[model samples]
Target: MAAQFRRMAMWTWPGAVYNEHPQRMVERLQEGHVDIVIPYICGQRDGHTCWTAEEYDERLRAIIEEAHRADMKVHACFDEVNAYRAMPVYDLRQVRKDGSIGSVLCHANPAVVDYVLDKLRWTLAEFDCDGINLEDGYIFNQNTIYDPAHTTGELFQVVPVCYCSYCQEHAPIEKPEWAQWKQEQLTALIAAESALVRKQKPGAPFSVAARMPYDRSFYAPHKQEVPYFDGWEVCQSRDALMADWAAWLRRGHIDFACPMSYFHSRRLVELETQECRHLSPTAANDIWIGLGLGECTAEYRQGNGDDPATENAKDPALRNDGAAIEALLLDQLRVGQEKVVFFSYEHLLDEHLSVMARYR
Candidate 1:
């Protein structure tokens, strides 16, 4: 019983066999009243090394054609650092604090940026996607660097990372400094990717599925806080990543920002939507508050990397329920006047589809 959204979208992840059949996937999406479909094409590592660029383009075209036939637009969704094995091997790993290594492709390396841009360029030119959505993989990880011993003999540690001589050759130093450099590099990357998308297809929508900032009050009276760095500052400071999404949105570097506000509480959803609106009033309309659904409660517990002991003790009624989901969607539309996108078709059930039909 809420007003309809001007644009409705759905996101899909890799290994989601629910999307094995593109036509069927498109049909289900259409049935759910989705106006756009963003399917994750890049696997664990970059798509280029996973498969030939030509093959990637061919497969995307097949899905694009299927969506087009159903009157739905397709946006090529890629994970920025979701690859387990990136091509051009040298550009794949991030340096950890203890001089160990991380699996994500390092942002400090221009070669990695070039690889991502090249893929975007070729995909835009060869495929008929309506837009591009780059999902930032700057999620939380361990910070191992230790600060000097305090007078009290307390050891302060940090997640000094991406210290590979190569990263230093490009950005210099680690941890906090790496954060600023990471923002700079990622900003440039998004800017460059946007430019490429426009060059290939002028006026094409370019977006990012960015990380949502931590909501200080989500757990409230209980006094438990979501991991701040992992969800917010850590990716920026430790991973040398940028989730200061509003700045990018305001600058027009990105057309739309679908922040992953994966909270179970509808109240928290409103809070984040308000925060994003305040952060970029000029582009608030461009912010689509991403809502989680279908196995979301389980996914939150199992996937988010936070201490399960703490999070598991919370309410079980937080996510993926038909009535609760309807309330969340209505809250976005009514309170935020914002658009919404569900996580994936894999977790979505018939009841979820039934709720979406009301908006249609």
Candidate 2:
């Protein structure tokens, strides 16, 4: 037998219910010794108008209750960056450098923060979830994003956000420093949310779906080889993304940080972990590497733009083979990683489950 991880978990969205019942999904995961189930419950899901926690209450409760019966901890995930609706939060989304609004919400604005936390507060009170997770938990825009709205000729006009009226009207400094101001906004948001979670459920783990830096040296292989990824100068690099999650970890605002460093290349994975260890010795242990079953290559959108949920995923052609998954899973274990979480539950194949069960 090989070494096992401290906890095995998955990130999933509301669409998972279509393929199998939440109850059965939890049971199968339990069979593979997966102890944590992190499902996205808040924010507007891509295709459906899953407006609030109340709308998802039944399925969310089903996932929680069944996971509990399997003795698994359920962590409800919230997307900090993406919220699309006619609501106030959507109205306050990050403004592109071109003056157009981006897809992600703006946490820098107090009103936006109030709306997000209000929903989170309700979720904590209602669900029997053991913890909370924030995906894209930052306020940032980058040139690397390939927005379907923008043609290649006009790509130079966007930075993806923070030029909204509040930022323009409330200039903290005549010329606020970019990185410092962004860092402050992100850290403050995490502190407030973490405090809220702990206050509601003392000792619950507060985790972030962390990001990795893009560099020619370490990340080249992932970019050059991966199917749909663009070779941006910097996509979701921590510093530019304004998500100083390591600072949050040092301040005890979060229980752990899981960087989404999904790659089939062992070299990229090693470099990714090396970067995490280099972030801060004090915070390194809390960094859980995020692996993925497959990278999403395409998504189906209707004329009105609602993404209907499906089991096979928005697309599944590029999913790693069973052998590749087995090797990647073992490679991380051998390299002294204490924790590893998969990118999705929807993409989990039978072969993937077997690999997890072997080590678990």
Candidate 3:
């Protein structure tokens, strides 16, 4: 039989901060029966900029040491989204249309790859972390590209469309264009980075948190375009997520899978459990589901509310409440997936603590 499933904390950078000292959070986590704490590290802060590599390293070291002392493993996130803030090139690749360049940076570019690798190296070398979590590492929004003709550094809030001269010049021969190619490149990068991390920290774990569903195109209007990876999906519905999840298990790219199931009703929870059962036969023994403890608001709970106007809004699927939290955990337990991770650390409140205690 497989080892008993363990609880993991999916913490955000700001959440980590609000948890105040790492030691205190670790104590609470232990009391809550958590086995791992995966803290988020955003690349930017307050919509302006992200910390330098050195600053990130210092923070990571503190968290890692504190958690380890409490017998809890620390899983550090190398968030690429926030990293974009510090990037000299705001776009991931350049797109060419109507004789103009776009803003997305080209992942094929050696410089971009090197820059990401350097950040990973810094994280590993500077901290005694137990694992590395790569979040939003693959999804590419359409507006990241910029026009090459304009060299001035003007901050534009709109999602950019890359139209750099280089993108235009190489448009015809570029094998992967914008979104599709970036996804493949990111997967390759993760495989390589995972190897690098393992080599340095032989016993450390490496995991990737991705959106669920095999086909997210159906929700395009909702901006839920699925990345082009063999494993992983982030979808709005559990049934939709399972359809793709079954495929991912057969492909075997994922070591473990965690679907963002933040629902409040027992009926939906039962549906999620049934979906997990269908996918389990194909899923690896280590595969587990994830839950969201943070991002819950009173308005969301009442069913007549406005969306939280914060960074959490970036992924509305994460918005959940205490009842939703209970339903998600109960479903996972009912489905026999002993291991579950919370969506974030920042939004966790006093009431949330009481709910987690029942599980312990």
Candidate 4:
């Protein structure tokens, strides 16, 4: 018989993998009734890979074998352009409007796209994982600078980016040209990656960890005092970020559009799911509602007015909020969301696991 829900667990933090063996982790995931595990494999943060490529390979294989034994699948997750290994070329990295070099690599750069696609090909070929998930890379960043005034870097990824030589040279000189170019570049990248994934894996799922669907009235800048809250939405604007994920869905590049709706409120979560269902072409299991079980404003689950008080925390930790977590897990199930990928396994404590196990 089919399970209650196809629970997919995400594991992004390298610290979790670094501390515990892959076998032990998969065992815990099985306990949570997880059918799939999406792990951060070739991700880079703070200017370094958490482990060597050899170590990643060994760890990934260990995870795959262990997960398969437990009847669970492992989808090795790849960070698109943001988590690149290295970009020595100045033109490869994005340039901020302030004339400073941006942290994220240029999406439009052929060398950058080539490197990412080659890396994706290599990882899928090397790792005996069941599937794949892609995330990040889309942020044009400082859209709120124009849309919603009182700006601070805390909300967005600092400022608008990717005025690099590549974009400047290739893009036509016109108003809104840069944003349009950015969207095309990312779409093209997804298409290429999707083609490659389908060719190589044949049956493996190509999932994308996209931002929640845009609803201007419900979102900040339109409603809330602050505009760019990471907990509520991905960016100030999807167009500004060039995250045309709805179109990607229409194009059918992604098998699953996992919206990262990491909001604390149940009402907000429902709103995001509704928006996703209304906007996206895919339905059922294809719209994987990503509940923020990891590190976000994850405590309260209430209707409490339109915009309730929210706390957005960056320090990744599993708080003692079993009641809230359970509510999210079961509520999504109640609403008939066939698949829900919890933001992470790393932040899930023993209590959280207990709640997860009992949900099934």
Candidate 5:
């Protein structure tokens, strides 16, 4: 049953195996029955890149070969715009409306887009892997900047962004269509990368790890604005990040739309699973629902106060019960069309593996 679902695991570099014990970790993954392994090759977060220049290539090939030897497929996972591990190459900062900088790749800049295409091709060529997952982090906030001069090395901002001269020239901000243009930029970027991947490796699968909606309500952006906030301004899925993933699936840009539905409650998990299925019923098999194991819990499920009680933290449902975990897994499986992929392997325990192995 797990084989039917394409059981996969994600591996990040500069940690555990990538840094040390590469072969051992592969062996461990085999024990867990992980059929596909997605490795984080290049990324920049907090200030450190995942792989260093010297050992990046050699080490990645080694890990890939190890996974292959274990009869596991290696899917290249690229951290889109979130972490530029190969810094300075595509580290064009995103400038917010307040003139602050955010550490994300500016998709509006032609150079950055070109760099992404090149990088996608390079990763496919160098790695010689099975396929690719154009991983998310495509800017949840509107504070994106295209002007290179405003690169202040600042973090994410709460305000809107990119009223710069370059953005103005390419996409006039004063126009009501500016938001649509931004969404197009992201969609185009993915489309270009997908085309390259197909050209490089014919018929290879391409998947995307996307953010899932918490509920029917999309009012997080308007929480503080209260009385001044007009009801239902724009769908968060459409505008903020411009992740029209259903369209991507419908357009055949990605083989699978894996929503990271990391909810603690089995009810919410079922709701999200159904939502993904409803997003594109015709392409229902293409949707893979990502479940969070280990210490993953939703904030809403957590109590309202400081050090609030949480289900996974306190209850045995998500904590220690193999039956509980199995029940949740079965709930998602009940969707019939949707596949399941856990967030990580490190967080999973022995009981988790035992239950998962049954499905395998």
Candidate 6:
């Protein structure tokens, strides 16, 4: 059999549930034969947030150096708004109707854009890294819409944004409004950031984590609905999402697009790989599909905690071992995608490392 595709592991500093330090995580990755490390710099959960630059620089730097020694590229993850709903900088325009702040910011606001750009600039200046990954940066609620009560033609939606009195004061003036305007704002923000980064470091890599839409009308009606911005489901279908991403790639906005293919079964991976190949021929050659190692295990599928399952869900008596992960990696290589990234390193253990080692 042909050698399997190379593997990249994800590591988060200040640690997530596993609480592994960067140095130790690096060691594990090296042993696993990982070719790249995508370290999580910042992320949000509920109301709490974690960032490595402030507290774990010493450890982070050490890990980066070690990975470099091992010939591994380091990809820094800047999570703009994954879950906790906080931006590095706050925008006054993204206030909610109830007079409270929202989790995400309005990309239309210059201040928000500046805040993100500054952060990216700082990261490139500070780190000796290969590239940067912008995770969930362009994400917005599909239920959002233009609010006439707040401002004329002002874009509003169910995302509960820009209620800080500024956006409310300057709502848009146009009627027969469309939520596409908001999407355009977001796309512009992404493009601008990508441009700025490239200007500073030509050929540096950039990517966005986009939601997968299965069909054109999947997010319709709700595509631009307020309080939720529901229409995204229509425009963000799988084909549409790929097409949108193709435009970015064609424009040379990003070096690669890593779609979140969070599938549990090997079959699903095969199917998605075919679809991606068909939708993005160029990206298919360069794309690195993101898979959830911690979440795809048999124990995870059975809804059991992290405990190992007695038998494989697909084959009882065939213990849930490193074989499952090996199968996944092999499948990725079979589909012509050479690069595969694990969701996180902090969540991995010795067993996970062993599985990754098989491919290496």
lDDT of every model, 2 decimals: 0.63, 0.67, 0.50, 0.65, 0.61, 0.55
The segments of candidate 6 whose C-alpha lies over 4 angstroms from its true place after superposition are 6-19, 43-53, 81-88, 91-101, 143-177, 214-244, 296-321
Give the root-mean-square deviation of each candidate in angstroms. Answer: 6.3, 6.1, 8.3, 4.9, 6.3, 8.6
Residue 130 lDDT (model 2) = 92
Pairs of colliding residues, candidate 5? 44-83
The TM-score between candidate 4 and the true structure equals 0.83
Count backbone overlaps in model 4. 0
TM-score of each: 0.81, 0.82, 0.67, 0.83, 0.80, 0.72
Global Cα lDDT for candidate 3 = 0.50
What lDDT is reached at residue 202 by model 1? 85
- Models sorted by lDDT, best on top: 2, 4, 1, 5, 6, 3
Q: Is candidate 3 or candidate 4 better by lDDT?
A: 4
Q: After superposition, how far is residue 18 of candidate 1 from its true place, in Å?
A: 7.4
Which one wins by TM-score: 1 or 5?
1
Residue ranges of candidate 4 with Cα displaced over 4 Å = 1-3, 43-50, 83-91, 142-158, 213-237, 298-320
The 10 consecutive residues of candidate 2 with the worst lDDT sum are 297-306
Local accuracy of candidate 3 as per-residue lDDT tens digits, 1-360: 223345646555553643367677777777666777787654343342355545654665677787888787877766643335457555554443443433334554556667667768877886677777766433332332111111112221223223445444543343444444444444556566667776787767666554433343333443322111111132221221112333333444335555544433344334444555565673324445555554442223322112123232235443555666765666666666666677667666666666676664
lDDT per residue (tens digit) for residues 231-301 in model 5: 11221355555677777887889888777765555765666676676677753468767766654544233
Off-target runs (Cα >4 Å) in candidate 2 are: 17-19, 49-55, 146-160, 172-176, 214-232, 282-284, 295-318
Residue lDDT tens for model 2, 1-360: 238777788888677843459878987797667889898876346576544535566777778888888788998887645766745567887775678777777668899888877877888998888988887646466434432111122222225357788877753433557657867887888899999999999989998887764333445555544322342234445545667777888898999888776655555567677767766574325877887675421221101011223333333343454666677778777766667788688778777787788777
Angstrom error of the Cα, residue 134, model 5: value is 1.5
Among these predicted structures, which one has the highest lDDT? 2
Residue pair clashes in candidate 1 = 44-83, 44-84, 45-83, 45-84, 143-159
Model 6 per-residue lDDT tens digits across residues 256-354:
777655545565456546556665766444577766565433223432111123233334322223565677788886666777776656546578677
Please report the TM-score between candidate 5 and the true structure. 0.80
TM-score rank order: 4, 2, 1, 5, 6, 3
* RMSD versus native structure for model 2: 6.1
